[model samples]
Target: MNNLLTGLKNILGVGLKPGSYLNILYLLLAFPLGIFYFVYLITGFSIGLGLLYIFIGLPFLLLTMFSWRLFARFEGLQARWLLKENVEHDSPARWSEASGFWNWITSRLSSKYTWKGLVYLLLKAPLGVVSFIVTITLASVSGVLIIAPFIYKFVDYELPWGAISTMPQALSLTAFGLVLGLLSLHIFNGLAAVFRWLSRNLLNSGQRLAVAE
Candidate 1:
């Protein structure tokens, strides 16, 4: 746990600029892909539902298994644009646009990257849920703390979170707000850490260029 905390700290401490925010923004545009992936999984998993499109469904779903490189490409672009880290991406490998369907599937199946990419895709949902919860909780907590003191003397406003039993009608309430702010920062550190480690493992898997001739 201590090591994990330290790693989180290290990742959060990395100098990030406005571009880093844009890197995250890049994900917003990929929402369509995310939705497609979700549907792909749902349909693929349904025994009777996906039989009609089995060929495309199974292959496309499997192809998503290799999308980690696609995800990493964005990360690499971010690294270069945000942190001046110019990671190389060999032009081509197992994925061949012109190859026959069977060749395409076989090529991806045989490569380590296909597996890695698939793994990354699999983890996305869980990480997204965690991140959403942490971010929202932190923001809400901080907001309550920050705003509570302003109306402490007023009648009463029951916070949705019944935790603030005592109306924040005092200076201490402001202190609580500060704590929430710091706590949010702490969680952000964790998010950044996990994201970095995941990116490294999934995106940086192929050290050698396997560009097909």
Candidate 2:
């Protein structure tokens, strides 16, 4: 019985940990950032490629590549801070000191890492949406169920699925909520792991390129 109680305590405590909260925050931020990245890349690439025949498209495409590189670096930093993972990326060489705009563009275009960064940015939107939806839905449902007993008593109402008038019923709902909340935290942690993996592999120039080669 003591072992059972300890296990229960551990399960309940998982949701309240600081790291779990950070994972939640990271997932929440991913949604908006993903939408922005998807829109920006889609628009930029579409316009740039559409006008590739003209003289102007080359510069636009180069600019888009540079933008993706910067965004990848930012994502690496975010993962390091929020996911508490070490994401090492290769620093871009100082091409401006050596030559002009064309030189910098040529370097970016030639690098496989630049292309991988673009791929990561392109994938972020769908992954972000999935993670955000799952996290928010699970967290919200768990939260509501956890407090349903108190709310039912104070507001003189029962939940749609069942009544919470009796103490046992209320306790059951609370217990279920506790378990569900822990499950939600686990889900968040899992998604955080995936994002961290992506950041470490796709966003990092040095590691990804080396592995590919």
Candidate 3:
């Protein structure tokens, strides 16, 4: 009975938790960041590959590779900070440990994490779109409904059901909104968990694999 009660409390109290707000913020940032990452990465790769015949293309290719690594590292950090995920990032080989600069670069390029991170980065674009749309749509509807009492009279309010004119209607909608808000938090939490898993498995699992070998 006690455990059941605790579970119920957790479900209902999601909005009161600070983590819920963090999840929302993370989801909100996903759309813009995803678009930026997708555009930059695709452009960089296309340009780098297209110019490979020219001597200058070598530098472009190298720069694009380095850029992706840096982006991956930033994503790992962001996951740790926002989602409270402990992502053990892939570390580069030390210059001192390598025979030369080229050797160190090769070592980094050969690592499994390098490719995995790239895949994760690419996946973010689509995932971010879905997460952003769901978060915004649900939250906006709930917010407008919650505030319907105060704004119903002032604004020309019309939902799919109909216009809300009476205080009773507004109050009932507000109650429904509160429930919807709680559900949204749960959805956000689930999405955050997916990101956390991706970060842990793709962004930094190279270190663990290296140790195993």
Candidate 4:
């Protein structure tokens, strides 16, 4: 019983932890970053493939691939910093140091990690949107409910559908919001865990293949 209470207290107190704040910040950033990545990927691929009939398409594709590699590296760094996890990737020699431009391009195109990174980028937008929406909604609703008593006392406002203009109602709403807010923290933590797993598996698990080669 004591252990359960302690665990509940710890979860409820998650906001005091630096990691919880960092995770929230990371999720908030993901919304915009995800949009940018999705836009860039679609635009770059369309332009590159559209011009493939001419030699221009090849260079465009190469540039796109190079840009994606850099973006993936940035994401890896972000994950490492925010998630506080080791995110590994293949060595530069595997794709960057080929004898010729074509060879370098071919190496990147053939690399498994490149395709995996592309998939990750594609999925990031949707995952980010979901995370951002849930986090913001929970935070906002919790904030409003937690302050219901003050709002009722000081402001002229109509109680929303199920809400009542009474002290007990206000206190009950506050308690509910507080519990929900703590649960939201746990949800955000779970999201951070998922992202860490994705980064470790998709962005950084090519070392063994590199060694084999």
Rate residue 46 of model 1 by lDDT: 60
Candidate 4, residue 78: CA error in Å?
A: 1.1
Q: Candidate 4, residues 103-188: lDDT per residue as tens digits?
A: 66556666767777887777789999998998899889889888988886675435567545688878887898898888889999
Tens digits of per-residue lDDT, candidate 2, 1-213, equal 999999988777886689888989999999999999999888888889999998788777777877988888888889989998887766655776638766555556666678777888888899999989998899888987788677757644356885668767877877889889888898889899999888878877652233221
lDDT (0 to 1) per candidate:
0.54, 0.81, 0.86, 0.80
What TM-score does candidate 4 reach?
0.85
RMSD of candidates 1 onward, in order: 7.2, 3.9, 2.6, 3.2
Model 3 misplaced regions, further than 4 Å: 159-161, 207-213
Better by TM-score, candidate 4 or 3: 3
Best by the lDDT measure:
3
> Candidate 2: where is the Cα deviation over 4 Å?
1-13, 153-161, 207-213
Worst 10 residues of 4 by lDDT: 204-213
Worst 10 residues of 3 by lDDT: 204-213
User: What are the TM-scores, per candidate, against the unseen true structure?
Assistant: 0.58, 0.84, 0.93, 0.85
Question: Candidate 4, clashing residue pairs?
Answer: 88-204
Better of 3 and 4 by lDDT: 3
Residue-level lDDT for 209 in candidate 2: 34
Model 1 lDDT per residue over 106-169, tens place: 5545555555555655566666556656666766777766777566556354556543335434
Q: Which pairs clash (backbone N, Cα, C closer than 3 Å) in model 1?
A: 65-118, 152-169
